[model samples]
Target: MPAPTLRLPSGDTWTRAEYEALPDDLPVRVGVVYGELVVKPRPRPIQRRVARRLATRLEDAAPVGWQVDADVDVLLDDDEVEPVELAPDVVVYSSDHDPYERPISADLVTLVVEVVSPFSRRVRPSLYAEAGIRHYWRVETDQTAPAFAIYSYELDDATGLYVATGVHHDRIAVTLPFELDIELKGVREPRRRRRAGR
Candidate 1:
């Protein structure tokens, strides 16, 4: 798809009204980062696969009061001019959260997962850490293999930033987020079998 031509608001800080006024049928996914507009084309196949399957796996393993979701907008910052609404690839959140909120509030969120895309190789998961979400995971392809890897982080309360927890490849077994021990390979694309030794 061609890049959508846009005449976005010009200023240091864009308000919520300006964001809501954007065309609802845009060809790209849209969000705000500290009042600045952030847009990206939809996820490619590998990105989608990892996010969806992981969400399902997490939800299945979640404790009673927690749940997992994919592609839900989180109200990270609600500042009048610099309000932020980021939609992470996958999220683990509280089940008792109110349904009436327009976008899921940041406080209600526990963990957020992002699949590294070429367009967002350096995208800031720090935004999530700043919102006080306890855990953040980043998915990226391994340099030495065909499978993906998970780099996990825990919030550092003293610095208001995220600290590396563990890098998971074959499996994800974490204590917080409820003693998870799921195979990371399941989220990756299935390997194809060669027929007749071709």
Candidate 2:
């Protein structure tokens, strides 16, 4: 008989080494929501491609001192668990700091992006808010409705909840960090279908 795996309580803290030892494989993506583990299926090609594209855009748009990372895990301390692993599709960390194998919190990440799945939606954005991430984007990749929804928030130092600054998209021409303006059309465009009888 196989032994049951022991589960940790909520808000537990674990070291980086301990967090990496958890049994999670690629293609089946995983993240920590509070102290519990959340698994997701691997992203499709379009999603991956779009994420990469966004990374490139941020790189060019960001100021000289900023850096971008794709699908990297940002750690958040949960008392019962070693650390919460949050692997956003795209994240930006300031170049003025050194990188850690496991982040103590989502504060290391200035921005986090997720490409919405066709079926299920991952709750990482809420988790990121809990972990103190500042900016977030929820990408809807459905063929019928392709759009990127941008969200910005101010983190409460005392509460740790991110308060939304009212959602803004490319239409607003909001310039961020590196003096770069993000346009929505770059992320998506309307497709024109041709008539078969034409």
> What tens digits encode model 1's per-residue C-alpha lDDT throughout 30-53?
888879888776887888988989
Clashing pairs in model 2, backbone N/Cα/C closer than 3 A: 11-78, 11-79, 11-80, 12-78, 12-79, 12-80, 12-81, 13-79, 14-82, 63-178
Model 2, span 4-122: residue lDDT tens: 35345324544445556665444467665544556667888878877887788887777766788888777755544445676778888777556555442465567777777732254
Q: Assess each prediction's global lDDT (C-alpha) against the native.
A: 0.82, 0.64
Index of the highest-lDDT prediction: 1
Quality of model 2 by C-alpha lDDT: 0.64
- Please count the clashing residue pairs in each candidate, in the order shown: 0, 10
What TM-score does prediction 2 earn? 0.68
For model 2, the superposed segments whose C-alpha errors exceed 4 Å read 1-17, 22-27, 78-82, 96-105, 118-122, 144-160, 163-172, 189-198
Q: How many backbone clashes does candidate 1 have?
A: 0
